[model samples]
Target chain A: MATKIDEEQLMNDMLCRVKAVNNMPHDIRATLLDFKVDGYKVGKVRPGIAEMLCNMKTSVFELKQEDDSKKKSYLTLTSDAGTSSEERTKAVGTVMNQLRDEGFVKGWRDELFPVSENFYSPPVFLMERAAVTVLGVLEYGVHINGIVQESRQDEPKMWIGRRSATKSKFPGMLDHIVAGGQPSGISLIDNVVKECEEEAGIEESIVRAGVQSVGAISYENWDPKSDKLTRAVQFTYDLYLPPDFEPKPVDGEVQGFMLWTMDQVKESMAMDYADPIKPNCYVVIIDYLIRTGQISPDSNGFLDILRELRSGDCQ
Target chain B: MATKIDEEQLMNDMLCRVKAVNNMPHDIRATLLDFKVDGYKVGKVRPGIAEMLCNMKTSVFELKQEDDSKKKSYLTLTSDAGTSSEERTKAVGTVMNQLRDEGFVKGWRDELFPVSENFYSPPVFLMERAAVTVLGVLEYGVHINGIVQESRQDEPKMWIGRRSATKSKFPGMLDHIVAGGQPSGISLIDNVVKECEEEAGIEESIVRAGVQSVGAISYENWDPKSDKLTRAVQFTYDLYLPPDFEPKPVDGEVQGFMLWTMDQVKESMAMDYADPIKPNCYVVIIDYLIRTGQISPDSNGFLDILRELRSGDCQ
Candidate 1:
């Protein structure tokens, strides 16, 4: 029969067992311990660690000083901190220590934690189809349809689009038309057109026709190593102009209006591109018009001639 | 004194150890073993089995069969695999039986096996940079400076370009006019101008007088997991032209050639308009040129017709 281990002794014994089971060398074990403690102080642990510990065949509880008394609670290895290796290491230590010191190791052997279920395992043949993901952009234009005579103002005002409140990702800035991907026969163009109408409050079914322009942009953000700011096969399409293109701003998302010509709109876009005005909107719309020759290439073009002028040779 | 383990017994003991160490229950161990034996065997089996055995700390060696008196081999797990409960179960019947029958388990224990080195340690923070990995074509266009006489069919054609290959990731495409990227820069235009003359063998002293076009396109055959593709921001410029500009195409990468008008090149880009030509090469170049007004809109004003058609009210 094995000697009854005290909580601290049990924890130390389990740690030794963990090292042996994991086949980790002495140096590596020390490194892992240091890494775990430091990671715990800072929040950067993956939630998976808690699940891993919970599944281990050991019952562990942690004691914390509560006022004058010590309160006992089951130990879990989870932190809101970023999921870095250091954080993971700390979580492992905290859980192991709690369970060992509590003398719950034997109890854990009697209880079983939930095991993760396996999803579908596809064969290798479906690799190509599985790899493809789609990305796209819906381009709208502020057309100078006709000059409206303002009842109060002396100047002839051109009808312009109202500013959108949903500038970033919101009900409309970015919305998931479909939470999960459709299986087949999904036309990207039709989907984009539908999404714009739903999110941007575009009423008309003016699909951007013709192959006007194409290009790529890089996107990057920190956090979640597994997450990437990429959706391959992203396409941009300009909206078709409808005769009764009356746009009523969507409630809560879009705020009301501004009337400006091609020049004023361009200038506003130039002033502060990513301003409340949404500069990329202007770039996409202008590019479409220029390519179709609906608008003249404002002398120097959309790419600011003055800047290019400073640089030698156009090529 | 420790009991002497024969070859088969030694292998069986090791398999049992590995199972215990990995915490694989008996049911899972059975499943894994069955799967390894027959569930998947599309390609080479020996190497795959070797890889799996290596993970289990198993030693597979060649032995001489008594019947044939020729070299044969058997596999056995080492003592290092003993720490895991999961590994222990898997090794019980198969290799351990062989080791005991052969009576070579003691000799196997004496043989030194190489240990696996830890190459990948999880990093403290995953700091990764954004990579632009593909090129796209918006549109394609050509400009002509002077009229080509019918009699000058045999006249030596000229092409403007660099003599030697410039430094670029995609050296196979435009050898002299290399593509470069400036991740952090004031403007994409500024970076493009700097790269042009340096890579294309153009004189930097001459200023780019006008703004051309801003088009859009996207990439292809890019994989985020593999990170195999090279990406760079590209700025296409009109090799500064005068009123009486002549045709010229430099050798090496860009060989000498006569300049063609938009009409002559329209057919080539026709593939992009349709799906015949891959979208990137044709559509990207065409869209950029047309958006810039390098080639004026088609005579019929196809864009206007398209807009009118979309606007049902317009005649």
Candidate 2:
């Protein structure tokens, strides 16, 4: 009946509205436009837009303008039934509360800013970096912790989530569990410890003993919204575990967690993965672990950078 | 005064029209649309529309019901400004007569089509494969030949046309005459010698020694046209010559040609050359020569791919 809407088109339209409202200046217009274009959207939850809004809100607090001190929380109630009044109002209320508590939406009003949700559409065969983007964007704020299982006769193994098919943007996927959504500038080491306890049901003391090293992941993707596709930037961090660490799924979010040798991970990834987001994270994590002698990519033709990355062994 | 026309918008309009007219299939639509979005205008010529018309004509011919007896010609007419009408008509008649004599444009009158006069905007820079398409669509029937200048330490320097400032698509640029074009494939090797004679004004018996290699270059810029960009695929070959291969400017197409030592060419390209195109073409040629041991990239840090290709190298 209606034209099948595209994520890009929807974003372009929303950005045009923002421009119209602000009488958008050229430079600011470019940045906001970029965020909308490159931002991650899940139903009404746009991670990029949300991240920008959070940044803007934080900046407002820092500026300490006179108007900001007396900010009032804008709240509205909505039903969960098939009525706009209920669900929409509830969604706004949830955001308002989270923002006010986080100190971002002190004076923000509750308004129905219709968001066009984008579903995950991974490439037919995802490379490492692309896999990371898919996962990071889809599960923007989830925290995860995982263990690296090593054996003397074969490549090291790692335990991680077989993400819930219902919640997975990329269904039937498995990847390491690592911390996500700690406050932007907080120490990653602390966040990983907390994330392990919460995400994998491991205690902080156990996490402290198991935790190994911390490294970061960065990615670039073509974003048509900004008309500068190649320069779009996204980043992530990984938390590793020692050879003895074991993991158990703590909540409903994880469908199942698997203990996979490096070769198994590579082989399974090649078969099931279609985005670079998860593999990119694994590449960084595995590369770090292997380089440190915790694992080896070439032992069984698994963790080698040339094999895993260059030769597209996963594919 | 009319509003400034956005080249992107104009290209989009043209692409939409083409798609609608030909009922372009989905696969082709995606590729063509990608091109329209990424490309930019390279140049405009009086016979500018010839390229577009030729593409549209061929595609239409393909889409039409099967007609094996159909024939077509892609031709451009040029004459001195004061040529008589009869002479112009006679020229067209002679070409038509030749086509009939050759049996390439004879059987089906209704299906026989030629590139009649048409309007064309300058070639736009798309962020995709523009140059290759130009070769495929407009220059398909043309043949190309490659040649390399012999080491000329003992020969006299030559001059050809200075890079055409007004006529060149990429104005104020100079590039190596990598290959020369011919009307028929059979005479391509001869055309190489012919091009060296005309462009470099060298009459040496250029020998096609051996096939060195072939490579491709892809470059796209977002800020310039914000749409189209060019990707050039070059076929390079090495040629040998007598030690006394003297060179000089032989035609008006090129401003001047000169014989220079490797050091001199590098210095001229890096510091003395005034045209932008010359440097791009020179850099590639110099890099190739250096890698092949004909020159050096380290002497003055000039003509080095490592230096030139690194992000922010010039900056």
Candidate 2, residue B88: the lDDT equals: 35
Model 2 regions lying over 4 Å from their true place: A1-154, A223-245, A271-315, B1-315
Candidate 1: what lDDT?
0.28
CAPRI verdict on model 2? incorrect
Please give, for residues A1-315, the per-residue lDDT of candidate 1 as tens digits.
223323333223222322221232233222211012221211111233323444555422121222334342222223432245444334434444455455532222221111111011111111112111100011111122222322211222333444444443332231111111212223433455454454345543343421122221111111234211111112334332333444445444455434444444333333322432332233233333333322322221322221111111000
Write model 2 residue lDDT over A64-166, tens digit each, in one string: 1122454422111113211343443344344445545765333333322222122113211111222222112221232333545332223445566765666
Worst 10 residues of 2 chain A by lDDT: A306-315
Quality of candidate 2 docking, DockQ: 0.01
What is the lDDT for B210 in model 1? 25
Every candidate's DockQ is 0.03, 0.01
lDDT of 1 by residue, B1-315 (tens): 223323333223222322221232233222221111111111111223334334432442111122334433223334533434344334432443354355422222221111111001111111012211110001112221122222212222212222323412223231212233332313444544455444434333432432233322222222234312222112333333333443233334433223444333333332222312222233333433333323322222323222211111100
Interface RMSD of each: 18.6, 20.4
- Find the 10 residues in a row with the least total lDDT in model 2 chain B: B111-120
